[model samples]
Target: METLPLQDYNIYVGDFDQRLSDWLAEKVYSRLLIIVDQNTKMHCWPLLEPVVSAYQHSLIEIPAGEDHKHLETCQQIWQTMMEARADRRSLTIDLGGGVIGDMGGFCASTFKRGMDFVQMPTTLLSQVDASIGGKLGIDFMQVKNSIGVFRNPQAVYIDPRFLRTLSARELRSGFAEIIKHSLIADREQWEELRQISDLGKVDWPKLIVPSLRIKQRIVEIDPFERGLRKALNFGHTIGHAVEGHALETDAPLLHGEAIAVGMIAETYLSHRQLDLSAEALETITDFIRRIYEPVALDPATFPELLRLMSNDKKNESQAINFSLLPAAGSVEVNRTASPAEIVESLEYYNEIVAVGNRI
Candidate 1:
């Protein structure tokens, strides 16, 4: 097990071979609650039962879906913990993807003025991005992860075994973040990832080295998100707004899918607004389209999406903040954007992708 210590924070990440029960035996804890979504409860918990035998383990299964990322769902989870008699000494084992790690972390962070939690992140997205970061929160009023706090976990056990069970779409969704990570930090990793073809063919152990290195380096520079940490929000500006809008209604896009488009479109903004190269923009857009089908935004939906962006959490004042990629490893924040300019950028992105699809 290669352990990486997250300093001054409880977050411990590792490709751990030792069982969670054995790890927990060293620490004094009152009880254990293993939280899982409906799908994870059915597919994942059986493997854990054998490993977490030393503790008094209980399962708290919640219905899966973006609609459930609300205060009501969180309240129910808290209620269950209360019944389970979870106190400060108790721990939460978040055993699933981003939604599980994110929402579960929020519950543990607030439970009894904060209880410790471990992230047994299943999905590739959660393991590489969401789970590793101490950002824990739930959606509010149908926004994408709007209500949350930055609280580190006690441990993050990343087992690549879960990738075998992921559907192709889910696999593609996670790869998008890997692409984002590469774009933000390591240009070499970017080129290497671009060379990757079949997502199923990847050497799992090799991929984590670059991915975690980028996140750890970024977080270390600015743990409180005062400066450099904001760079991680590269594709998230419009991506999150689109996610928030779609999640509210009939169809919702995955985080990576929206971000794929977000990164492509944001590339245009980066070039025009931040002087990023045109070649790099094309490289990112082309690669993302290989994994994600760009959604055609109707004339009606585009405006509503913009409205969501206006309310983005990063916006300090009334200006919508953007993380523009001027170079491979560099980004700038607090970009002042006009409504007309933002709309034009989205329209231009659609034209490029639509032309490509038709060809």
Candidate 2:
């Protein structure tokens, strides 16, 4: 029954069955649509089916992976809702990870001028970061989140049971966000997290709350991402570029994985631009490099990645901007970086990997 109440909605965190059933029973809706990816259809839906079994509900499934997060996928959702005669009173239960939560929420937010939606995040990444925020949209034209809107859900349901089904790689991917949260907002949380040598055996229940709180506090101050919330994009500018390139090459990186790499590169930028100390940079980079494999950024791919970053929504007047750390738990937002500084940072990332290779 743990909860984080927002302006008009509440995020219920804990056991899902009773909370979901109790919440649904109280709402008056025309129909219920549970949107999921293929992975969740096989693993997560069964756990949730019994709770919503009595209600009028239908399932909309999409192919799994970040590569499928695009306009065509959203069209299918709109078509399904239209054929089903879903109205403003209809509720969408986004029952998977970040992709499902984001794409489903985007669809619900836009369909028939909007409908009520709920988030039942079934991945560590979603549970801790993506699901709580109102940001909803899909990648467009090879750019990450290029066509999204900010729209809060009716409610968000988070239960850690879903983490049990995730693979080791998925778990590690999600941990990158947890690490990012700590680095940007909570020094003590960063201290607690850095001690862990094994991700699989880490205490998730304890780890998740602090990360969720960091994001919630920021979102509360700037739900529309005008200023304070931009700090939450700490690694996303470069991360999104790396992600877009990965997707274009047909070797899509998970959102968190790409961000992990982005954080390392941006940490270098932070040192050069924000004057973050070398010691702090090393500590941060070492931890992240241990968790994620370096994306092979051919010097040739730098232009494409740079092009992707230039298109980031955070930028203005064609200047490349970043949300960078001056130190752990401290961020400076909307700071501009020159192309030379960016290429240097990428080279620094490559140097780190090359050094690791020699070891």
Candidate 3:
């Protein structure tokens, strides 16, 4: 197993069974609180049950999906922990995708003034992106990650074997972050990624390792997100807004799906403001369009989308804050775009989708 050591923790990316068993044996916590949703409980639990079943642990299963990621679900997790008689010395094993990792970690971090937690992310999205950041929270007031805290997990165990359970769409959803990581930091990796036509045939461990390294460098430098860490938000600002708006609709977009839209729109902003070449913009938009399903924004929803962006946690002032690309493999943070320009970018996204639909 290859390990990427962060300042406070190590992210194990490979077969994690032995590593996890060893870690649990070494730590020997007073109790173990294993958090899972319906999905993970069914598909992922079996893989983990063998190692952890030997320990004294309580299983807390909640509903699955972004819709369930709220204060109400947190209350349920907290109540279960209370019933389990959990204390700071106890360990929380967040064994699921991003929602479970985020909400579970948030619950553990805040429980009795904080208990130790380890991330055993089961999905591709969670393994490469969500599990590593140390950013934990639930969606609130229709704002993505509006309520969160920065606290590193004791460790992160990413076993790619868990990815076998994902649907094709879900796997594609996770690929967006890998795309984002390459675009923002690794130009060469981006070149390698755009060439990928089939995810099933691809070797994930090779891709996940480098992607983790890119994020590791950034998060370690600016864990508080004061400056350098903002670079990681390259596609998140607008992506979060799009994601938040979609959550209320009949058809909601996955986190990475929304970010794919955000990346295209922000790439447009990059071309217009930062003078990124038209060729680069086309390369990005075209590649993303080929990989993800096209999402057309309603003109009527522009007002609400703007409102969501306005209230983004990254905003330091009245203007919405964005992290835009000046070029592939690099970014500029603390950037602001006017409302009209923001609408224009959204329109650009719609126009492209409309054109693609026609063809």
Using lDDT as the measure, which candidate wins? 3
Pairs that collide, model 3: none
Instruction: State the lDDT of candidate 1 residue by residue for 1-359, as single tens digits.
Output: 45566664433344344656567778888888999987887777777867777678779998886678788989989999999989999989999998888999999999888999988888878878875568888988666778999988877887777777888778777887788888888888888888987887887657865787788888888877887788888888888887787776677788778788788878788888876788877777777777687677665778888888988887887888888888765677767678887787788678877866886
The list of candidate 3 runs beyond 4 A from truth reads: none
Root-mean-square deviation (CA) per prediction: 1.8, 1.1, 0.9
Give the candidate order by descending TM-score: 3, 2, 1
lDDT of each residue in 1-359, candidate 3, tens digit only: 99888888898988888989998899969899999988899998888889998888999999999989999999999999999999999999999999999999999999998999999998889998986678999989878777879898999999988899999888898999999999999999999998998888889989999999999989888888899999989888889989999999999999999999999999999889996899999999999988888879999999999999999999897989988888999989998999999999999999888887887
lDDT of 2 at 41: 91
lDDT of each: 0.80, 0.88, 0.91
lDDT of 1 at 349: 76
The residue pairs in collision within model 2 are: none
Candidate 2 residue lDDT tens string, 9-95: 888778889988888898888899999888899998999999999999999998887888899999999999999889999999999
Off by over 4 Å in 2: none
Give me the overall lDDT of model 3.
0.91
